[model samples]
Target: MISLSLPSPAPPSFKPPNPNPKPHKPKTLKPSSSNPLHNRPIHHLDQAQLNKAISTLDLMSHHNSAADLLTYSLLLKSCIRFRNFELGKLLHKKLTNSGLELDSVLLNSLITLYSKSGDPVTASLVFEEMGERKRDLVSWSSLISCYANNDMEFEAIVKFIDMIELGFCPNEYSFCAVIKACSVKENVWIGKIILGFVIKSGFFDTDVCVGCALIDMFVNGGCDLESAKKVFDKMPERNAVTWTLMITRYMQMGQASDALELFLDMVVGGNAPDQFTFSGVISACAKLGMLSLGKQLHSQVIRLGLVSDVCVGCSLIDMYAKCMVDGTMVDSRRVFDGMSEHNVMSWTAIITGYVGTGGCDKEAIELFSEMICGQTIPNHFTFSAVLKACTNLSDLCLGEQVYTHAVKLGLASVNCVGNSLVSMYARCGWMENARKAFDILFEKNLVSYNAIVDGYAKNLDSDEAFKLYGQIEDTGFEVDIFTFASLLSGAASIGAIGVGTSKQLFKCLMK
Candidate 1:
């Protein structure tokens, strides 16, 4: 048992202590035979062994083996590496008890630990507690990255502004983080400013990663695909990831042919496409229903030995499903049956393709049953897809089961899930159940309102449809073309027109 001189640990408050707290210097201890870190090899150990080596709090204490700043930093990194929140908090206690004023390095370690552990609020507090002068490049970069990685994009941009106000030069990572913040918020104006900074920093031409992230930012953030293309075209070097992202973005932009053409260009340019690239190109082909191109990509997948990849297999299923010949999915089902492994995405793709295509609602429902009976947990999309099967079958019992399953999975409030529930019940002539589901919805989108109103109209319940219409009008939900179409259809169906009546009189007057 070793007793080390330590300052009193601060109260659990996160408030910044006096910046100039009285410093207590500990007397250096001789390496003891009982000390853990000194007893074994430290440098050659991997992260797991390193973690296990320092598992005990007393083992790494300041008095035991004369631990220094470097030792504490290494241990903090372990906390982050292992996502060990309790150990991180213990280190903070040890840090305060040791009376070492937490500087940028140690503070950044704390920020990284908390951020990786999924506690961005504490990371922000640690950063804010730093004195004005103590906020260094590492400090700014760590805090900004903390916000960005944790999905606090707006706060990340705010911190970047603060970093710039302090006259600290940002590195390429800082630019990447701020640019990602812009992408998340779709703030092209701010993204352009950050791009200009990156160019000024000379990272635009030299850093490949910076260029790739910028491409996503421009297209996704700026909503300007041409700008993204310009950035991709001018890059001094492009990797597989860059090509894959561009191809995926092209598909997202409705340029499926362009995505395939780019894939060809990549092969011609001598870049071997990876799983992600193949997945994107295959998906593009599926969207365009280009069976010939899809087959060609499939052959390439076989040649590249990617036939076993779950992503490529799922893409193939989607492509085969969409590229129908003679109005049957014989080829798609065959391919799906051949798959040796199936994940949640795999199940989801096939279920959606089955139900969404014409006249396969029964098959989709069966696949969903299999998915439920298997190890794969059905996601919200799976529930949504299977619920459409219920709509087509008009099985009130089945729809209710799906609704119950959705609630059990905590997806009852998801817009797609909730909308599908209303659609299912309405299609089944179960208007009472539909109304109850609609009322319990946490939030309603236009699709939800449309489904319910259309359900009422299709069930010949025009009164209920009009009642919901009036409610939604005051509720501030903007109606779309589908809404009017359903409403007019309901109105026309609710009354016969022009049987030598008022509509006939109006027609005669017009003539």
Candidate 2:
């Protein structure tokens, strides 16, 4: 039984703040607009505003805005906190302009700032500027982490080898970075080598950091869930990150039920879920399409004060959208409307839900319009989803317009979007346009072939559909049962009794 406390009822705040949120807008020092640091106690400003203050001072050319130890440290912290590469770049330019010595501490912060912001190019530039002799262990670790965090696994692993060559022994953080890097590329041999390093460095048992990272590397990176479970089972301690990682990996592997089981275990064991934990389990519930379970989780989110978290809010939007029956995206829209921020993921999730669940495709398309007007860059998935909506609505003109948008965005060639366009054009009886889309695609998976062929077939183009059916074999795509069925149906529709009989016999032989 999943044991959870019935959360204390509170006056409706409507949207919940993330757990560990800033204390009701604490009385932090505000930087004056004229001069960011003027009349400001530097230490009293929150990291977020401190970053802004730093930017304002730089912009105003505050010549006296020196990068003192305290001021620079706060600036670096701000860069890390905000994931603001532009701010980090400004700070770096200011540091060089000030002719200040690039100390190890300052350089590490810059490297970390750039790395966390997914800019290893600049991070490496900072690392290369520092001589190896001047670099302490922290510098080496940060440089490796810069690559690892940015998904440059090869770069990170190569740097780790170089660090080992330089005789700088690996620490727990270094191991964590290396392990995380391994999780992306699934170089199990390299991961095995990293495990050896873990054992040799005497961190395998003692360092809980390595233990959790190893589990993540195995399950997430290597896709070896059994091994991850073993590592977690053997670990003497596990924190929220570890538990959250395990749950998320389970979801990634399509083991949402197992993820929910572990989430229950984590809660029952008194490990109160943080934002990520709730996000993962709620996502699992959404996948299961269990509306009641999803609602229960939403209540828990409200009670735990995580509704305002962008990630949590996004998950809630997706969950409510998926759990609701067709044409019932009201709850999902409410969450999106209430959110203080909306990233591409949040927008994509709701759009996908609306289209995929056969809900309001028109609403999905309208939302996409709003997203574009708001300047949220729509990726190929967004194009794919909205195109699907157009197909469902039989809005060929609108579908063609979205296809134009896809071309403008360089997403027209994306497999799913391309397939969707073919499907859309076909469903709307635009055979010539569908064939054009089918012809231009560089690669055609079974789904692609099915979409285009089905489109042509459904439109009563018996000759064109049969030609394409023959071309599927020439192109080395085995015709599936769906192919024969659709083709025979097309033949039947065109009153081609002979072709239908031949296809039926061929299908039976193939089967």
Candidate 3:
């Protein structure tokens, strides 16, 4: 028993005796022989150790002695570092009651603690309490960052402008926060205006972080991609995040070739691509069906020891499946099997690859079963893929069972799952059940109509097939090659190809 003077712990909702309580004199204590923590520096302790120290302080009575502002500030820093919101709130209550003055440093720490805890309201309260004279650059910057992180973009931007109006020079962190706010608000005008300030501040060329934020502002605000590229190209220094953003944006814009080219440039620049970059570039390889280049990237993936990442594993599976060499899916399976664990995305990717690759229906179904037995919940895409396997194998019983499982999971009415259900039932000669599934769909797409029309045509139901064909235009979907093929096949089977049918067929051929 060693006892240190400190405020006794109180509930989060406890109010102090008054707004400005009289300060208590703090008496320094020497190391106690009984408590090991008495000798240890508070700032050097990890979060768990700091928590134990706080617990020891909490047991002391308010009348025993009081901790100085520095000790309280150090405890607040630990709370923010560990994101221990409860402890921080308790400490806040104690600090307010301890009669220690709240300085700029402690107030900034409170703002950050509340901000990181997703309590922007409390952070705002703390900022307001700092008063105009005591608020420093760090206080304003922390508050702006708090608003930006909590989706209060408008407030962040306002605070930023206020900071500038108050004769405070905006720093790199300040510009990044405001720019992110503008990006989220989609206020391209404000974002461009801020870009000029960024140029004036000289952070655009020197600070990689500020440049990345500008690029993100332009790209995500739906502004011109050219502007984003111009900013990216002009940046004197770029980090891995910078390269990854450009690569990802290129892939999204369907410029896979440009993305791949940029990736080579990135490698040449000596900035090693992270797992995210690898995933994007590998997907670009899949999109272009570049088997040889994909293999090279795969080698890099293995060398960098990123082969076990779920995202990388999924991309590799997709790339191998799409860029198949000799029409075999051995590589995809190898990657999937090599992963240490499987998440929903990884399982879905492998199953989708199997379903897309021909003659692997049984393997896809088995994998689906394994996924289910492993207690991994399957999403709508998983159900859609497994149901397609049932359609390919014409296993009506298995399809019905899977359908039951989907219904139990409350995903039966999802568009993708419903479309697959219709296709599965119709292909297995269950037209009534297929129509039932089709009618239950919450939102029908062109694919759903195509599946039902093709099923009727294949089953020799020319009347229903023609009826559905006439309604395609009414549903705002253009008739495609699949629609024409189904109609022609139906007419040919029933000897119903008349002048009108011939004219339509000719029109389809012309298109």
Model 3 lDDT tens row, 399-495: 9899899999999889999999999988988899888888878998889999999999989997898788777778888778898889899889888
On lDDT, the candidate that comes out on top is 3
User: Among these predicted structures, which one has the highest TM-score?
Assistant: 1
Q: What is the C-alpha lDDT of each candidate?
A: 0.78, 0.80, 0.84
Candidates arranged by lDDT, highest first: 3, 2, 1
What is the C-alpha lDDT profile of model 1 across 1-511, one tens digit per residue?
A: 2111212222355644654366665433333345566533243233256445454435555445544565667667777777777877887877777766666788889988887877899988888898776778887888888888888888999999988987888887788878878885457788888888888888888887788878888777666789999989978788788889889999888999889888778777777688788899889989988888788778777766677788988898899889987677777777677788888988998998898787999989889889889968988888988888888887878888887988898988888898899888887878898888888888888888999999887777766776787776878887777876676676578673334334432432343
Model 1 regions lying over 4 Å from their true place? 1-54, 58-72, 78-103, 132-134, 184-186, 326-330, 463-481, 496-511
Model 3 alpha-carbon drift over 4 Å, by segment = 1-44, 47-54, 60-100, 326-328, 341-345, 358-511
After TM-score superposition, the amount by which residue 217's alpha carbon in candidate 2 deviates from its true location, in angstroms, is 2.7
| Model 2 lDDT, residue 318, Cα | 85
As for model 3, its CA RMSD to the true structure in angstroms is: 12.8
Encode model 2's per-residue lDDT on 1-511: one tens digit a residue: 3435532334457565765555676565344334445534353345446555675546435556444554666666776776777877887787788676778888888888888777899889889988976688898899888888887888889989999998889999999988888886456669878898788878987888889888878876678899888888777777788889889989999999999989888877777678898899889988888778778888888877788888888788888877787558889988888887888888998898788667578889888999999999998888899999999999988888989988998888889889998898888888888889988987788888888778877888767777777777787877788887777788778777685558654764575
lDDT score for residue 244 of model 1: 92
Could you tell me every candidate's TM-score relative to the true structure? 0.80, 0.75, 0.68
**Predictions: Cα RMSD each:** 13.3, 6.3, 12.8
Model 2: C-alpha RMSD to truth? 6.3
The model with the greater lDDT, 1 or 2, is: 2
Q: In lDDT terms, how accurate is model 1?
A: 0.78
